[model samples]
Target: MSPDTAPSAARVDPKLLRIAFILVLGTFMATVDATIVSVGIDTLAGEFGASVAEIQWVSTAYLLAVVAAVPASGWLADRFGGRRTWLAAVGVFLLGSALCALAWSATSLIVFRVVQGLGGGLLPATGQALLARIAGPDRTGRVISIVAVVPLLSPVLGPLVGGAILGTASWPWLFLVNLPIGLVAMLLARRHVPAVPPSERRTAFDLRGAALLSPGLAVLVFGLTEVSHGRTLPAAAGVSAGLAMLAGFAVHGLRTRRTPLVDPRLFAQPPFGAAALALLVLGASVFGTMFLLPLYFQTGRGLSAGEAGLLLAPQGLGAAAGSVLVNRTIDKVAPRALVVTGIVLILVGTVPFTQLGHRPTDALIASALVVRGVGMAMVSAPVMNIVYSRIEPAHLPRAAGALNLLNTVGGSIGTAALAVVLQNRLTARGPDIAQAFADTFWWVLGLCLLAAAGATRLPRTHVGKS
Candidate 1:
């Protein structure tokens, strides 16, 4: 049996499993693409004879485009059907990838990346919505738990994959690599991904809400990115404008007759409200640590990028194990219990990093990372299972959009905030760079606790109830 079918193949329909396999292929491609390019920025800059600042737009433009495009995904899936929308996204992504590979200059490459991001951004939330509608509530846990492994592994795998490509092939192959995976996914999707009819609710698209929300998210992420780079004035202007626009969208969502792009009201709903908050913080903690760890390994420990990536591999292994555990136990366990336990494990895992000043052994660091990875899988899968299971089928698309948006933005904010914290500590602590990382990890511990507190509001009982 394939790894994709593991833990509960007999319990899930074989067809659903096949659909999930295709969905994950696209998701893995998009998620990995986000980070894969980071390792190549220097190479890209050298090739184009551009400065680092100029080449950086290659990554930044893609991120902004993704943020702008995510809000529209729910409407697209509802207006046109999930399968069709998904296929279109894959097509667009493939086109962008090809364009990126053939780019004549840095400017062209950055623009092509934006085209890629538009499609890539829509993938995860839309795919989740489609899968949830097909699996229904009772089985969402098992299937989603299995599907969740892709993103969990992507952070560690991305840099490693990119490094390998750069070692063996030219940089264009980085983008070109997506073509084969995308084409296979598209072909499989058409054959196995059944077309669901569009929603009958006939409400017109919310252009005003889209105007406010999409640009608002994009600008906000840009601001946070600026914050990480220590550009104060631009960050301030972008963040303030983004927040103001988001507030306007919230007011618009509450008062509008037609549905808003992503309903702000969804965040106020019961277990969902709690789940959203948990995921928001979880995003921060997960992405924040991911941001910090590679730097820590390279600068503080003097490891090469490949060695840092290899050290990170244990976390992926742990998450894979945790995913299998969640697949088996999600139905049997209360969400609150699982999430709280997961947070505690995360706390345990992070403890070693906080003691980095002492220079812990490699074995200890690897073990802690494995524990952290397991904790992450545990927290994320259960939160998703609860939300997907409880929500009405019609709301899945928008809800998925909102949830993913929060997680994405939360990651940005967390990474930026931690970057600031790490920078401050590095300066204040002087040559004790390891100690500075240790201090920054305490903040990560605090984020885990915040998520744990949010988990307390989740359903205390099993999520199998109608």
Candidate 2:
């Protein structure tokens, strides 16, 4: 079970490829929805006659649901079988999308979005697990590389698509678009996904562990969101409560030792531990940049949301390019080297943003995004390949789920932290918020550098193996 020891390469099955593609489609819808509403906020506000504060719930509710539901994905998949659970998740997502499209008020939209988030949260974690299970070790990197395209494209595309739809159609068209995509995915998945027998399934649900973890995550996320909005005391309280709950969950998991919502013991392995830490730092830096860029485009440059999205396209394209390149060489490259290199690229990419002036041109920002995208692409697939390559096959599902959960938490923390920083700097510096953004970019640069430093600690190969 060494990193370099080749697992038996299963025959490439066209059916499995089709299933993976179908799963990617579902993931695309989910990830796209997470940000599509960004550009549509104004329209949604006008349509619902709601204030900005009220409309913010749409995003908050969806994110909370994502955090709440993500930890359960592995248990559900093991309990019900991946194929069945995945299909059901997609169904729920589509239903939520439809409901979102039909909603008449902000409240209804928020409610529907929670439903959407519940389904959406499962897609990434389970999709990765399913692909790993089906592809086996030899092809896992390549398969995940293909799947990586969804997240890479969806965020940049969200506002672009939303802008186009809003320009010609309506805001509702954002959610409406998911319908056809979801329906087609449902058909493809039903036709191609292999069904595992329920008799072979693990029956345990680990309800007690979930009860502890989910609420803790929810409270923490809510607090972080509040901090982003400039409410310090409530944010502090929420974070404190969340930490306490997390501690309690950890104790419970260790004391009981049966499968917990998250198996804390996975971190005992050096590779897994280092990779998770790297993922956390990388997630914070990467997602922090994502949140910052939109503000830079819209607020600093006075560009429209659509324009910002188009400018952001280079990052996504770069990521896609990186995924392809890294996947090709993943088996050959040292994971540590690739990760460190990726972090360096991220640092290089982010430096350009720190130099932006009041009237930074579209071309300038676009170039920076391209560089950032390239850095992201470099890091994503290799980190994944490294993690999966090192862990035991039987632990893939839970490991993947936990990795994904960490990613979510990291992104949330990054978003909230960066948001708070941006807000504070903007308020404190007054008209100098543009400079403030540059300062924040410096912090992002430092974070990337720290990630690189951490990545160096990853063994040249998985421990206990060649």
lDDT for every model?
Answer: 0.88, 0.79
RMSD of each: 3.2, 3.0
What's the CA RMSD of model 2 in angstroms?
3.0
| Model 2, span 229-334: residue lDDT tens | 7787998999999888889999998888577878888776777777788887777887788889888878887888877787888988888788777767666777
The lDDT of model 2 is: 0.79
How well is each residue in 1-466 modelled by candidate 1, as lDDT tens digits?
A: 3222224322777877898999988889888998899889999999999999899999889878877888888898889988799889999999999999999899999999999999999998889888888777777888899998887788889889998999999999999999999999999988887776677785689999998999998888888778878899999999999999999999999999887888877888888899999999988988789889999999998998888889899999999999999888888888888899999999999999999999999999999989988998998889998898888777888888888877877776788789989998998999999999999999999998898888999998875454
RMSD (Cα, Å) of candidate 1?
3.2
lDDT of 1 at 169: 100
- What TM-score would every model get versus the actual structure? 0.96, 0.94
Candidate 1 segments exceeding 4 Å error? 1-10, 464-466
